[model samples]
Target chain A: MIRHVAVFRFVPEFTTEHREHWMALVRALPDRIPQLRSMTVGADVLRGPASYELAIVADFDDLDGLEAYTRHPAHAEVLRISAPVKASLATVDFEIPDAS
Target chain B: MIRHVAVFRFVPEFTTEHREHWMALVRALPDRIPQLRSMTVGADVLRGPASYELAIVADFDDLDGLEAYTRHPAHAEVLRISAPVKASLATVDFEIPDAS
Candidate 1:
């Protein structure tokens, strides 16, 4: 298994209202990607001296599943809508071992 | 690799002050758990209709490494401090696929 974590840092300018709009776009992703087994989106409350503002957690069966999601058309839409509101984006991809 | 995610929800009574105390306790753990490869802690900003208040992301070399950290003396101290303020706690232990 593999988990893909995309961390985004939004500028203070976006503030409260902007996130709601971005969230709407995010909510539409799961239906678009079949390989996304689990996904969770969250905002960072402890923003003190940190560069990340939001986090997207996605669990997949393997690297290929993660790759499919990354290339899916739906993800691009999210990026397009998010382009204006976000200040920066960073990603960390790691593998998950089998339970047995 | 194995990722241990501890999701916690704190009641409104917690507010800002309580988290600072918990964070201090958290920063001290890495020093004590050599098996703890990486750790990230964040507070939820959306505050929407969710039960989670804090999310802790930890990466370990494998399951044994995770166990070592769990049994380490420092982890006990965290539980003691957290026993009071938390409303609920949930954990998901996942294995990471090897690079090779």
Candidate 2:
């Protein structure tokens, strides 16, 4: 499985409202798409320590599943909603060891 | 790779002193053990929103590597110090997608 960690930092001017909207969209993705093994996105409640305002963690069966999810129509809609407020984004992909 | 995410929560009275120790132990593991691939442990700077106090993220080649790290003398030492202040712990193992 591939783990994708995506963080979105936005202008604090719209922090609260933007966070709520982003999380809502993320929470809605798994229901709309398949191969989304697990999905979690939330605002960092801690004030200054967390540099990014929102984080989304999702697990896919493999890279193909992940790529498909990223290009899925539902995710595209989320991006559309996201474009207006995003200040910066950071992403990291890591591998998980296979038991076999 | 096997991703192990562990969250440790302690009595707030000792949070400051204890977190320093927990993170110190985690940060030290990579240098002490050969099996560790990656390790990160930090406190939740945002208050009230995050339930866990400290989260330790480590990725190992497989479960055997993970077990070796856990049973390794260095980790055992950390646990010995951790016992006095620990309140609760949560762990999850997930797979990362293989690009191949």
Candidate 3:
């Protein structure tokens, strides 16, 4: 399986409305995007300087499944909503080997 | 629970030996760190420009548990081994709320 991990640093002005919107969209994605095997997303509870505002981890069967999830219209919609208020973003996509 | 997610961009010269070493160390952590709830780690299978070589997600009971794991000597040892070969590192530690 391939897991895509993304961390988002939203603008300082990001509010609860943005949080609710983003979470709703992400939570609804598994149903919209068939290739999305599973997903877990949450916000930072700590006020540490190194903490990012949001983190998302999603699993797919393989690279192709990940590509499909990225290209899906539902995902594009989420990006459109997020782009304006997003300050920084970092992502890492890796394969889970059978053995540890 | 708090999830500590870290993505490592290894230096260009990072070798297979380094990969083996890191994997073995990470895989052994659960036995040594009592605060660790779970962990999943892997390397990038795709050579995309955006890819980070290694990704790790470790869950703990709470922020204190995470702090304990971070201060654990075994984890510090792993960090010492990885520092030289790591190029860039990005991490996001977030709380998983009770609701979706």
Candidate 4:
């Protein structure tokens, strides 16, 4: 499997409602994107100095599956809403070796 | 549960061996820190424009458990080794609500 992890810090103007709407769209992705094996999205609870505002962790069978989800219209819709409000975004895509 | 996600960007000077050593230590953390419910670590595969070098995703039952894992000597040791070579790091700690 491949894991796609994204952490986001919203712009100063981003409001609570914006966050809620964005998270809702992200949480609904697994149902909308067929390539998603599993998905989880969450709002930061700690709000620490190093903390980002939100996170999305999703799993795919392979890079092709991940690419399919990334190009999916549902994901594009979510990004369209989030892109304007995002201040910083960092992502990591990595392989998850099967357990022996 | 609380999910703690950390993504790292290593310094330009950091070499492949340094990354391997760091990952080895991070992968061994669950055995040294009992507060962890589960943990996963991986080096980035995509090397995309927005990609960070590595990611660590760990779960704990609650904030207390998360704190315990964070402050544990073993975790501190890992940080001692990683901090010097790290160029940037971002973290998010968020609640994982139980399924209804």
Point to the candidate with the largest lDDT: 4
| DockQ scores for all predicted structures | 0.04, 0.05, 0.61, 0.86
Give the winner by lDDT: 2 or 3.
Answer: 3
lDDT per residue as tens, model 1, A1-94? 6666556656678876777677656655777789988776656543334325666677789878877987999888887768787775545454
Cα lDDT tens digits, model 2, B1-100, are: 6666655667667767766766678788999988988876656432333345666667778778888897999998888877677786545554443331
Could you give candidate 3's per-residue lDDT for residues A13-81 as a string of tens digits? 779787877888998899999999988888877657556678899989888999999899999999998
Which rank order by TM-score, best down to worst? 4, 3, 1, 2
lDDT scores in order: 0.67, 0.67, 0.84, 0.89
Residue pairs whose backbone atoms clash in candidate 2: A1-B96, A1-B97, A2-B96, A2-B97, A46-B46, A46-B47, A96-B1, A97-B1, A97-B2
Q: For model 2, what TM-score does chain A reach?
A: 0.87
Candidate 3's displacement at residue A92, Å, is: 1.3
**Can you write out model 3's per-residue Cα lDDT over B1-100, one digit (the tens) per residue?**
8888887877777787878778779978988999998888877776565566788899898999999998999999998888888887777887776453
Worst 10 residues of 4 chain B by lDDT: B91-100
Poorest stretch of ten by lDDT in candidate 2 chain A: A43-52
Minimum summed lDDT over a 10-residue window in model 2 chain B is located at B44-53
Residue-by-residue lDDT tens digits, candidate 4, B1-100: 8889999998878888888888888888888888998888899999988899999999898999999998899999998988898889999998878671
lDDT of 2: 0.67
TM-score of each: 0.51, 0.51, 0.87, 0.95
Docking class of 2: incorrect
Candidate 4 TM-score, true structure as reference? 0.95
B1-100: candidate 1 lDDT, tens digit per residue:
6666666767678768777778667766777789988776656533434335676677789878977987988888887777777776545454444551
lDDT of 1 at B71: 90
Clashing pairs in 1: A95-B96, A95-B97, A96-B95, A96-B96, A96-B97, A97-B95, A97-B96, A97-B97
- Quote the chain B TM-score of every prediction: 0.86, 0.87, 0.91, 0.93
lDDT of 1 at B100: 15
